[model samples]
Every structure is written in C-alpha cells, then in structure tokens.
Target: MRVFDAKLKLQSQLRLMRSENNTIGMVPTMGALHEGHLALVRQALSENDVVVVSIFINPTQFNNPEDLNKYPRSMEQDSKLLSELSEELLIFAPGIREMYPESVESVSYNFDGIEEVMEGKHRPGHFDGVATIVEALLRAVSPDRAYFGEKDYQQLQIVRKLVSQKQLPIEIMGCPIVREPSGLAMSSRNERLPKRLRKEASFIYKTLQAAKVKFGTESAIEVSDWVDNEFNIHPDLELEYFEIADAETLRPIRRKQKENKYRAFIAVYAEGIRLIDNIALN
Candidate 1:
C-alpha cells in the first residue's frame, strides 16, 4: 500500500488510474482504524478496480473542542491495518494544513428537514462542517463511487442530499453498521470508553432493539419514552435524544404513517464520550 499526505499528489496519482480506465472507489474516514472502517474498505475493494481510503480528522465538523482534541489518531497502526487488507490499497492521510492550507470562514449547508433533527439539533453547524469536508474530499478524489457506513444514518442521508445539491456524478453507497459481538456499534470513539463501560455500551443497541419491538404496538411517543426510561435505569448512560422518525427526511414522527419508512435514532453520553446509533422500525 502507498500513502500520500498531499492532496495534489494524491489527485495526480488518481488521475493516472483514470487514464488507465480504472474505476475508483473512495472511503472517507477519520483514522483510528477499526473493523468497522475495514469493512468499508473491503466493500470498496470488491466493487471497484481501485480503492482510495482518506484518513483526515476534519476539525470543522466538531462542535466541541474537547471532543476534537480527544479524537484518536494512529497513522502507523491505521496504515498497517489497511496494508494487511490490500497491498494495492491507497491511503490518503493529510495533515490539517494539507487539508486546509489557510484559515477561512466556516461552510454551511441546507438539507431542508434532513439537517433539522437528531444530531443536527444538538450539534450546531456540525453537518455544515461535515458537508464542507465531505465535499472537499469528494471533489479532490473525484471517484466514480464513495462508500460511507450507515452507522451515522443521518450523516448518510445528509451526504446523499449534499451529492444531490452539488450534482456530483458519484454514487454514494451506504454500507451496513458493523457492530461488536456484544452489539455495541463499532466506533472510533469506542476506544475512549473505559474497559467496563465498553461492555455497558452495548446497552445502547439493546435499548434500540427494545424500541424497535415496542414501536410496532406502541405509539411513537410511547416507544420514545420507553427508551428514555430504559436508559434511566443505567445512571452512566445519559440519554441525549431518541426519536422515531422518517428514515429519509429524519423528521420525528408523532404518529406512524403506513406508507413512510421509520427508524429509531438514538444518542447517548457514556462518561463524556458521545455515541450515536440507529435501527430500522417497521
């Protein structure tokens, strides 16, 4: 595997691949590589002639400075893991200066209702930061296809919206959420969890599963309340928000619509590390 720290050189190399008629697949990630990340890479490798994995921790996306500061970075370990997966894989690990050459005003995006719920509600200007970096990476790589994990379900939908708004001719593929054997959603932030809390973290998924079951017979509000109560039993698990919302628009649904699809979106704080996860509810 080869690594490039500069955008120009990476794009230039990708250009050579395009000239050779090779199809490119891009997986954009903030490093601290885990099985979940590798899962995206595996999907890209199976479907595209070449796969480009970006490992840039975007500063603009973080609303909390402490969270940004504590976010994991292990370039050496990340590189080794990707190399073991595919000797031909290309890793783009750019420095902040490499990604943002100079300071500039923050970028913003309007996804209509998509950006007004759940994560968007709590983290102000978060998606704009996400959009800024995603758009920048998509523009830089200019790949035929880009892969994102559905673990960040709202972000996935927002990205789809971003692509639509920009009219970028790239397929945004959303892969399934990879989880640990205990059912905790795989996340880079999972690294920060204390050993015991890590096991307790699986409760987040368990609560979502319960919400899914209750959602069928219970009203949206009832199911949401049930999830809140479930979290209340565990003092360490602070319930941020739980909503039964339209899977597409992410607008919280007070009453279930027969035709519209729905999902249970959840966020929680365990010892100051925020983790988000979602599950489909029929």
Candidate 2:
C-alpha cells in the first residue's frame, strides 16, 4: 500500500485515482486502532475498490488539554494492523503541521440546531474542529464514500450536513458500534483505563439501556434521575451530563416528539477516562 504524509503526494495519488475513475473509500481515524476502527476498514474493504485511511489526531477538536495529551497513539502497532487488513489499502498518516499548513485563524460550524446540547455544549469547539479536519479530508481524498462509526452518532450526523451544505461529492456511511463481550463500547481511550476499571466501564451501556426502557413512559427528568442513581453505584464514575434528546437536533426533549426517534446520550468520567454511550429511546 502507498503511504503519503504530505498533501502534494496525496493529491497526486488522488488525481491519478480520479483520472481512472476508481472508486475510493476513506476511514478517518485518530489512531490507537481497535476492533471498532478495523470494522470501519472492513466496511471500506467490502465496498470500495481502493481504501485510504487517514490517521491524524486533530488537535483543534480537543477541548481539554489533558485529554489531548492522554489520547492514545500506537503508530507501529496500528500500521501493522492495517497492513494485515490488506496491502491494497493506502494510509495517509500526517502530522498537525502538514494537515494545517496555514494559520487557522478561526474554526467553527453552524450545526443547524444540533450543536447546543450533549457533546456540542460539553466540548465547545470540538465539532468545529471535527468539521474542519473532516472537510479538509473529504476535499483532499474526494472519495466516493467515507465510513464513520455510529458510536459518535452526533459527529456522523454533522459530517452528513457538511457534505450537503458544502456540496462535496462523498457519501457519509456509518457502521455499527463495535462492542466487547461484556458490552463495553470498543474505544481507543479504553486503553488508558486501569485494567480493573475497564471491566466496570460496561455499566455505561447498562445505564443507557435502562434510560431507553424508561423513556416515553416517564418524564425525561425522571429518566435522567434514574440514570444518575444507576451511575452512583460506581464510586469511580463521575457524572458529567446525561439527557434524552432529539436524536437529530440533540436538544433536550420537553415532550414526546413522536415524529422522530429520540436518543439517550450520556457522558461520564471514571478514573479520568471519559466514556460516552447512547441508545434509541422508543
């Protein structure tokens, strides 16, 4: 597989692909490859003739400095995993300087109305940076399709808006959220969790499931309280924010919006490892 770290080379490769009208798929990742990341690669492999994986940890997306510092990176190991997937897949692993060649004076996004709740409110400039980099990537690769994990459902949604608003020629595809046998969502940050706490982390999903079960029958307030109570069982966990929101808008549901399926999204801190999970609220 060809590896291009510089924009010039990547553009050259892309132009050549465009010339031949080759169908290319992209799996954008922040490295620290896990089964979830590989599942995206698997989907790409199955769909497109060429798969280009970008492994750049975009710094601007991170709201917390500590979180950025602790974000996992295993370049050698990740490269090996991708190679095992196939020698046909090309990897674009670039550094911050290369990706952001110009002084980015500002980066923000009007995510319709979805940016006000859950992740957007919690991590202020996160989705903006997410849009910035992913936008740059889509422009760079100009792939027929791009694969994203459904774990970050909100982010995936924003990417779709980007393609529509910006008029980019790319299909935003969301693959399933890969989980472990114990039901813990497979995440790169899972590597940072203390081994013991790792097993306990599965409760996030359990609590979200409980919230899903309680959704329409009870008030959003009651469901949130129940989630908080379930979380209290784990001393190591710190409740950041929990809410059942309109899945598309990411706003707190005041009444039953039967027209749209709502989602219960939660973020919690346990042993300094932040984890997020969501389930559809029927």
Q: Best candidate, TM-score-wise?
A: 1
Runs with alpha carbons beyond 4 Å of true place in candidate 1: none
Tens digit per residue, CA lDDT, model 1, 1-282: 889998899989998999999999999999999999999999999999999999999989898999989998899899999999999999888888876778733587889878877898999989989998899899989999999999999999999999999999999999999999999999999989999999999999998998888888989999888887888889788999998889887888899889999999889999989999999997
Lowest-lDDT window of 10 residues in candidate 1? 99-108
Question: How does candidate 1 fare on TM-score?
Answer: 0.98
Error of 1 at 127 (Å): 0.5
Model 2 agreement with the true structure over 16-50: per-residue lDDT tens digits: 87788789999999999999999999999999988
Taken over the whole model, the C-alpha lDDT of each candidate is 0.91, 0.86
**Cα deviation of 217, candidate 2, in Å:** 2.8
Question: In terms of lDDT, which candidate is strongest?
Answer: 1
Model 1 residue pairs with clashes: none
